[model samples]
Structures are given as C-alpha cells and as structure tokens.
Target: MQTFATLRTPQTTGLPARSGAGMLLMWLGIVTFYRIWVLPRLGITLYVDEAQYWTWAQQLDWGYFSKPPVVAWLIAASTALFGDDLVAVKLSAILLYPATAWLLFVLGRQLFDTRVGLRSAVAFSLLPFVSGLGLFVSTDAPLLFFWALAILALVRATSMDRWRDWLLLGVALGLGVMSKYTMLAFGASALLYLLLSPQRRAQLGNPRLWAAIALAAVLVMPNVLWNWSHDFPTLRHTADITHVEGINDKGGNVGEFLLAQLASLGPGFALAFLAGLVVAWQQRRDGRMQLLVCFSLPLLAIVFLQALRSEANGNWAAPAFVTATVLAVVFLSRLKTRWWIVVIALNAGLMLTVYHVRDIYRIAGKPVPASLDILKRARAWDVLARQLRPIFAAHPDAMLLTENRTLMAHLLYELRDMHLQHAAWKPQAIPQDHYQLTTPLGPEDLGRSAILVTQSGSAGVIERFSSHQTLAHVSVIAGPKLRREVDVILLEGFRGYR
Candidate 1:
C-alpha cells in the first residue's frame, strides 16, 4: 500500500482519460433516452409513489402533506414539457441520475484527475440501484442530484474560497433540503469535515462560509413557513415513519438493513466501500482523504443506528455514497488490475440484466419468474385503473371517496380525464397522510353523495352516509405476487361523522 503521506496527492494510475470522456457521455445519453421512451412501453405501469407524485404535480404548492414541494414541482415541470404520458411522469428520475453522475465526474476531476473522473462517472452510472431506480421517479432523484452538486460546490469553496462557489453551495444545499429532509444531515457532514482539518477550520472564521449558511437558511425559510401554517405535517410524517423516538434493540433488523444495502449497491462495490472507509480513516492525516471519510461516515452511521432503532430503507443513505464512490475508486485503484475488472464486470452485468430482464426472459420463451420481476408493484396498475374507470363513468354525479392512500392517489391520476370531485374517508382527527390532511370528507361535505372505494368495507365510513349500498366487487390479477380486490360502495347524503 502507498504511504499515508502519498494519500494527500492523487495517484492517477493507468486509465483512459480523453477518449473515455466521449464514450461516457455517449453511454449516458443512450441510457437516458432508453429510460425516457423505451421503459414506459416495457409492460410496466407507474409505481404508486410515482402516481402519487403525479397527483401532487397537478397542483403546485410551497409544501406538501408528507414531503416538501420539490418532488411535486419536478414532476409538474417534466409532465408540462413532455405531456402526461407515463414517460413524462418518470422523466425527472430518467434525467437526474445522469446529471448526478456528471457531477461525480466533475468532482473526481477536480480532486484527482481526468482518468479518475471518467471512471467515477462510469462506475456511478452503472450502480444496480441507480440504473434500476432511474426508470422510476421519486423524491430520491432530486435529493441525490442536489446532494452531489452540493458536494461539488463544497470542494470548490474549500479549495478557492470563491464567492460564486459559496453561493452555489447554498443554493444546492437549500434545494437538497427542499428535496428531502435527510439533507439536513449534509450540514453535519460539512461541519465534521471542517473541524477535522485544522487548516480548513480557519475558514470557519471567514465571512463567505457564514454567508453560505445564511443564504441556505433564507432559501429554505418558505418551506418552514409553509409547514408552520400546515401544523408541520412533513416533520410529523417523517417522525412517524422513522419512529426515531421509539428505539429498541433489534440486532436482526440492523443485519437485515445492511444486507439490503449490500444488495442495493451490489456486493462488490459495497464491500469495497466499507474497506475504503477503513483505509481512509487510517490516512485521516491527509485532508483529501479526510474529506471523503467525513462525508461518507456520519450519514451511514446514523442510518445504521436508525435500522437498529426502528427501520431504514436501503436507499435511506444514498447521498452518503456521493463521496463514498470517489473513496471506493481511490481505494480500488491501488489494488491489482483484476480487482478493478471484477467490479466493472459485476456492475455492468447487473445493469444489463436489470435493464433487459423482460427481453431476456421472453427470448427464452418463459414468463418473468417472480424472482426476477422487480417491477411487480408497477405491473398491471394501468389495467386496474382501467377496470375502475367504468365505475366512475356509471356514477358521474357521485363524488369519489377513498378509504386509503393508494386509492386516493392512483384514482386521482388514473381517472384524471373524468375530473371527479374526491375526498378521503378519514375518521380520526389527526391526519395519517396527504389525502386525509387536505381533502377528507367532513361535516361540511355531509350532504354530498359519494362512492366509497376500499379493500375492506369500512363500517365507520359507511355509517356516516344516510343510505348505503354495495355497488360492485372489483378484482384484478395485478402480478405474480399481487392479487387486488376491492369493495365499491355507493353512499348517499353523507351524514356528519360526530
């Protein structure tokens, strides 16, 4: 291994630089285009979250019930420019991953050299999760993009202390905050980086740093005010979801989360990443290596504990990988050539397998085995929506009443052409989701007739109506793993739920 002092300077080993840049660009463009056009027609429907985000996009706001407005705004812009096709709904994710990969390229070029930059871009572009998830839109897309951009800005600001770089830092950070609350952790990571470097800590006394902080605060203030007016639903929802206050010793949960993350990043890169963290820590005397560890470790440490406490999804710590990718590449660069080849081959294999899974199965003349069809949740959603369409057509005057989040969001988009008035069947005073918080049927809507849609007929909601009848029993074979069935009930003259 190279000495610790050498870690201070980049060691650019043999890798193509100039020609690689051109090739990487071409690959990114083709992948992005495929996601935009081809993926939509490949026997998949919008995932529930994608459909919900589409509903949010229809009416732009400063804040939303469960999240900030950035995701909604992103979908709105994509659909507005591209039209309301399934491709439009997912256009944001389709485009942002490539942009994030480019940010990594730029940052790697800045910190190391063009070779590392080109390789970093190629590695990130092919991550199993990035390649697979990029086809579906969600809040994670904008969150990760803004996060990578902010890391780029921080690197420049620390190196040159330029005003423009600081401003970019503030804007990227504020946008990250709007994209996902997890971004607040970025501040902690930044602080940890500065405090660890004695020379860099002197910049804490500089005016530009404070100015960046203030600018971020100002930019994020609107969402805070929006939350204030709305009783802080976003914060509450986050707490409820994470259950951060309720902690218990669940060793198995921590192991489950780690394994899930291993699957997400792919086994090769994930193992290399952990090994890199240890190597970087040993070279902590080098400020460059220190920067990588500070950014990667703290967020992951939090998520690791979070899983032990309650639970964490595999992607919860995705932003942490923004810097970890560079560290992993740096660590792997010094190893034998075969190690690099193995990582490349593994990532490329995952990309090809996931991207063309349907084609591969079809060519073999076999149905996509449930084991390989990760799009199971997205399958047949449009078909189910089409099945529900005739019910609304038969009762045009009756308002649509949803008894759960899934129906509220899916129907809002699936049946958008009908333009039926809709409300959530919320019995409790405290809101559980976006629909319950905003459009719940209440005392004011007592006299309005409605059709209650639910998996189980909610007796509480049915009793609120003056008269009720079982309208229809709807069923759809959604996928190999999912068989959906619902009860559609007609209720007239809704009586107030007292």
Candidate 2:
C-alpha cells in the first residue's frame, strides 16, 4: 500500500515530519492556482446541476425546492466578485476544494500527527473525483470544507474543552448541513463516537456539548423555516428520493455502489481503504482508532445499508472520506516500499485520463466514443444555448416557455442578455422543480403569446393555444453517439389548463 509520497509517523523520541507540511502547502497552492486560472476556460460547459444552481443564485434565499441554499449562495458570491464569466460562476469550487484540503491537513495533524496530516491532504487532493470536481463546481465543495472543519473542531474541543472550539463545531456542522443534507451523518457519527468511548462518555451530560448541538440546530432553523413556509418542498423531495417510509428492495445496489468505489478511488486505493475500515473495526478498542472508525465507518455503513435497502449514490458518503483518507494514508504507509510507485502511477494515470481524455483521443487519431466520453454532459450545452439564442432574441416579448428544468436553467443562463424568465408549463398543476415552483404558467397567461421549447414533443399543443406552430427544431450533435434534440414552438393565445 506504499505510495510515492514518503509519510513517516513521528517516533516518540525521533524527529517529526515537519518537511511534509511545507510540501503539502506548496502542492495545495499550485492546485488552487491552476483550478482558479486554467480549468474554467477548458471548454467544458457547466453541468445541468451547476446551471440549475446558478439559476437558483439568481435569487438568493434560505432554501430551494430540492436542496439547501449554500451552493446557490456560493455561486452568487463568486459571480458577484468575478462578473458573469464562466470562471466567475465556477470560482467557488475552484477555491473551496483546495482550502478543504488544507483543513484536512489541520484535522489530520490534530487527530494523529504532522505526517498523517500531510499524507491526508495529498491523498484527498489527488482523489479521482476531486480532479474532476476541480472542473465542475457543486454542493459537495462547501460540504467537504465544513465537514473537515467540524471534525477538527470536535477533536480539538474534546481536549481543550474551549467554548470557541465548541462554537466552531456547531457552526461548521450547521453550515455543512445547509450545504448538503448528507452532513446529517456527522451528527450520527459524533453521537456514536461520544457514546462508545469510555473516557469521554461522562461528557454526555456536559452543558457545553448540548450548547453546541443546540447552536447547530439554531443555525439550521432558518432553512427549516423556509421549507415550512414553502410547503416543505425540500423535505418532501428528500423523502421521495430517500423513500423514508419504506425500502423498495432494489437489488444489487450495494454491489453497484461498491464497484462505484473501485471506479472512484481506483482499485488499489479502494481495496486498501476497505481493508482499513475492517482494521478500524478490529482495532476499535484503541481510543484513537475508535474515533476514526466511529466517524468514518458510521456514515459509510449508513450509505451502504441504504444501498442495500433502496439505492445510494456513490458520492452520498463523501464526507466519511474526510477521516477515511487519513486512515487510508496511515494504512498505506505501512506497506512495502516498491508498491509506493504503483499507487502513485495508478492515481496519476487516472487523473490524467479524466482531465485530458478528449486530447488523448485526438492525439490517438480516434474520436472518443460517446459511451466512454465523460465530458458529454458538460459538452453541447453551449451549442444548445447558441441555437436558442436567436429564437429568444427575436421573440423578446414572447413569454419564454419550457417544460424541463434543464432547458429552463441553460436557456435562462445563455440568454441572460435578454433577461428571459420562463413560464414553466406544469401539466400536473404541481411544482416538481424550482422552475415550476416560481414560474409556472398560470390562468393570467391564457391569452399571452409564447415561445415554447420542449425536448419531449410539440404535437397536440395546438389544443392549448389559439394558434400553435413549430418555429424550429434544434438537433445538436454532442459526441459520436450523443445528440440533443428539442422542438421550438410558437404559440399564440395560450388557453388555461383548467
């Protein structure tokens, strides 16, 4: 399990690994700079989720229909500071992840020592998805940052018992929750760790701990209030996705997620990581290992069980990797020396393939097969944007109409110059997404002319409009096997759905 990076734990009587800290700092700085300056301009358009998040940023609020407001606020802040350029839009993640890596360094140092800190930071920085994440901004960015900070605060508070550290822990957990609901696992893990440990179990009665938990609850109360006032859309959406009432018995999801980890962390790292989790269970009697195991394993175990019962995304347990990275680094450091180069080479190769696959295909005189093209989602959005630009420009007075959230997000973004706002068609008279929630076509629009963009079908819509006709059809070729097609319809005098 040895990796290229030399990470040696400090001996009781020997010198500490101070040099590793400086190297880690340098690496973090370089990664941060490159993501900030270079990656944003590399021709990958924002993902649908990123565009939707950007649309949410158009109006900053405590919450949204499907998720919390942290990502929206983050994109809003970044765009405000850097203008509406793509770089500006993606700047949050471009900055957040590197900063998260540094926080990982601090957390590792507090939990173990300087060497483990350095190894953890380096390992996280090069994690397979992180390389891709640098190019695409998402909610996971701030969630990971706050996740690490919260753990660091918890570990420090256990010893220092300072009000300041406890406050930090509360705020971090709260902010992490506001970033992604998955941060709730931190609460579960913290409880498991605090309850199981013998030396610190008495602290359960401590007022300070309760105060911290209370603060976290208070900090998240605004989002909860927002949800309540909005008919609990996010909560209902969460329940629907999670199937809280019952498990659907989706088979092989547990195995799918396990294989997904192999793809995500690479085979060597994934295997070693699974082995480390096993070791953590076996060594739970030791206090330090118990802390790591409780924090790392609980969330992972929860996600796996969810997979077994219903289904879980590969990234659902990402925060667990905050501690797992530290544990994995420590585990790998104990392996044979020659194996170090193998892991380093393996991870580095995977990273290169992720970052430059298109270039690799070009150099090899072969087009990337659509199925193998990871960038397909990010590609062709701008093309679709261009196709609809003139239609939007010509019908500036037409009520912009769309039935799909993805179409609503990208069109609104690309057509920002025209200040287009959509009249989202809600056939069911119920809001399924943010667009439908805030912008549903209503009775007042019964006589309004509109330009309707639909990916599904334009047929039979004439029943709703006095006169309806196809304006243009957009068929964009993204990759060899990827094509995005949509119907552009001009509808005069919309009839009320009722």
Candidate 3:
C-alpha cells in the first residue's frame, strides 16, 4: 500500500501548514454559526417537504413512497437528541456542509495542490445551492456529504489498493444511495474512470474492489427489499419524475436544463466550472486530471442526455459540481484573486438574501409579490393550524380530515402536540403518497363524525357526508409579500367517508 507521504507532490507536501488548516477551520466556524443561529431565527417556516420528512422521522421507516429512508433516519437521530424542534429537524443539514467541505479539502489536496484543495472547499461551502440547503433539511445534505466521502475513498483506494479504503468507499456508496438514488451516478462515473485509465483498469481484477461492491450491495439490500414489497414505489416515482410515460421523442430539453443549472449554480461558479472542464481536457495526459474528469463529466453528460430525452431537474446534476468545484478552483487560482473573491461574494450575498428575504423587502418598504416569494407554501400552514386549534379542541372526538397531501403533512407536524387523529380522505383507490397509504379513512372510519377541511370548498365531499355545516371560512395572508390569500373552509359534522 502506498503511504500518505508517497501520495503527496512537492506542492502539497508542505501545503497543509498552519495557514491552510486555520483558514479551513475559520470558514467552518463561520458557516456553522450562520446556519445554527442566523438561519433558524429568520422567521421562515418549514417547507412542505421538510414537514413531510419530519413526519416520516416520527415513523422511522426503512423506505418511503418517493425516496429512500436515510433522510428520515437522519431526522429521527437529530430530533432524538434535540427534542423534536425545528432546529433539531434541521440540525443535520446545518452541520453536514462543513463535513463535506473538509472531505473535499482532503480529496482535492490528494489529487492536486493544497491551495487547490482550500479553494475548492471554500467554493463548495459558498455555493448558492449549498447555502440554500443549509437552511432546509432534505436528502441532499447526507447525499452530498457521502458523495464527497466516496470520491475521497475511491481516490485513496485506487491509488493505494488498500482494502480499508475500498471498504470505506463501499460504506459511503451504500449510505449515499440510502440518502438519494442519484448516488448511482457516482458509480457510473467510477466505472467510466476505470475503463478509461490504464492504471485504474488493473483494479478490475482486484478482489478488494469486488468486496467493496458486495459490501455496498449488502447495506442497500433492506431498502431494495422494502421497495420490492411496496411494489417498487420508489422506482415508480423516479420513472414518473423523468416523465418516461410521455416521452418527447423528437424534442430534447437540454438547453433549458443547462440554463437552470446556470441559475442554480450561480453564473460565476458555472463559468469557472466550464473553464475547469476545458483545462481538465487539455491536461488529460495527466492521470490526476483524467481521474477528476472521469468522475465529473459522465454524470453531467448522462443528466444532460436525460434532459434531452425528457426533463431534468437543475439539482439532478449537483454531484457533478463536487469534483468540478476542485477543477474550477485549480483553474481559477491561476488568475488574479479578485475573480474568485467577487464570485464568492456574490454567492454569499445571494445566500443572505434568501435567508433574510422578508426582512429585506420589509426594510425596503416593498412587498415581495406572491409570484416572486418562493417561500409562500411554508408561510400559511401555522396560521391555518392556529385557526383549527379551537375547532379541534371543541370537537375532540371528531377526526381531522383532508384530501390534500400537503395540508395533511403540514397539519401533522403543526398539530403534533395535540395528538390529532387525522386521515387523508382518499375517495379513489389509488394511493398518492405515504400518508395516503398509511393514514386512509377506511370502512372503520365510517359513521365517525369528522372535521373536514378543504381549500376547494368541499363541494364534492358534502354530498357523501350525513350532514354538514359551515364552521368557519378562513382567509390567510400567505407569504412574506402578504399579497395572496389561502382560503380554507371548515365543514363540521362530516359523518361518513362515503
């Protein structure tokens, strides 16, 4: 096995000196403080997805209808320690980025120089997408962290042929898959790297590599079994998102998807990433550059083609940027420092604006129009919950009912303290989500008086009930802009599911 000293070039041998270490530590502290303190106090409510994940955490499932179980498990762990508050729900997301940054630094330094490693760490930490992610708990947090770790482990395993590193790589891959299925893209990139590089190709015969594969397979087996038992709902959800059922055989959406990537990554980092790709291509003769490109480009191309065939999300290509961040810094560090600094500043500013968007508009004496307020969905749930609290107290025996999944999810979290017995009014046979699958109002619920809530005025549900009366009509000012109204009606005495 190759030693750590043997892996370092002259440029990196002395590069982990006090300055680099100190800089990394400083940045980690700054980011940690901001996420833990500033972000939680921003007055922004949890988005529907966040609330859904929180509800999932309470159940501690091995799988979900739309995603793997890792995110729910993460939330469960955090809330266990912190007592199930919003901060607890989001604590893992707040802390994961720094771990990701540190791993990125280790990988970058091993592949290139210490300066390149530091630059890449900073660039990744400051990425607009990452900054946004820190404020919200999602599957992406653990996914990105393990993705970087897998890359680091793979680089070490390939360079040293160490069983330990290979084993660690397997662990990272398994957990990454649990976080989000996109981790398969990293596996695809790794396969391409081995096929393209003569030196790495030898690893195909190494038993350690096969052992790694087996380990990852073993770790992911439970989720696979869960999916199989559940009719492969996760796989079906993935296919549905890709729009495979209604393929546009002739027209591709590559151009629009690329534009979305630019907007998501921020223009400066996107440009730097493109330049890095060019530089990596020109330096293809160097094995390290080839390794980076092999790990980066294939995923981008695959998603780009997917976009071409159907549609792709902006964040679908996110893991590609992990290696591209290092490549970008390596290329950008050659120029004046001002270039990278300005880009970092712009991203930071954008992050701050997102965190304090309501305050910004209020200070400027302007309302953030409903159309422009990205956080509108999160705003009015609590207000609705407050209005329903009295009604819930008055009719303690009546079960709360709603047909909308979003409403059901938010109400589950908001009224969690009340221990509300709620169920989705699934009139149809098909289950749309985990809530519908688990909490349907079945025959057992028939003849039980219920409090029915609906944004659509309950025209369809009224006839099915034994009798009903208008309890209250609520018009909530949703969003920071306060320009839109979310009107909900509470229908009392909904006596039957029929």
- For model 2 the local lDDT of residue 301 reads 84
The model with the greater lDDT, 2 or 3, is: 3
lDDT of each: 0.82, 0.79, 0.80
Cα lDDT of candidate 2 equals 0.79
User: What is the lDDT for 139 in model 1?
Assistant: 83
State the lDDT of candidate 2 residue by residue for 314-349, as single tens digits. Answer: 888888777777778767766764554476568778
Clashes of 1: 0
Assess candidate 1 and give its TM-score to the true structure.
0.94
Give the distance in Å from residue 280's predicted Cα in candidate 2 to where it truly belongs. 2.5
Model 3 pairs in collision: none
Taking all chains together, the TM-score of candidate 3 against the true structure is 0.93
lDDT of 3: 0.80
Clashes of each: 0, 1, 0
Q: Which stretches of candidate 3 lie over 4 Å from their true place?
A: 1-8, 12-15, 248-256, 480-498
Better of 1 and 3 by lDDT: 1
Q: Estimate each model's TM-score.
A: 0.94, 0.94, 0.93
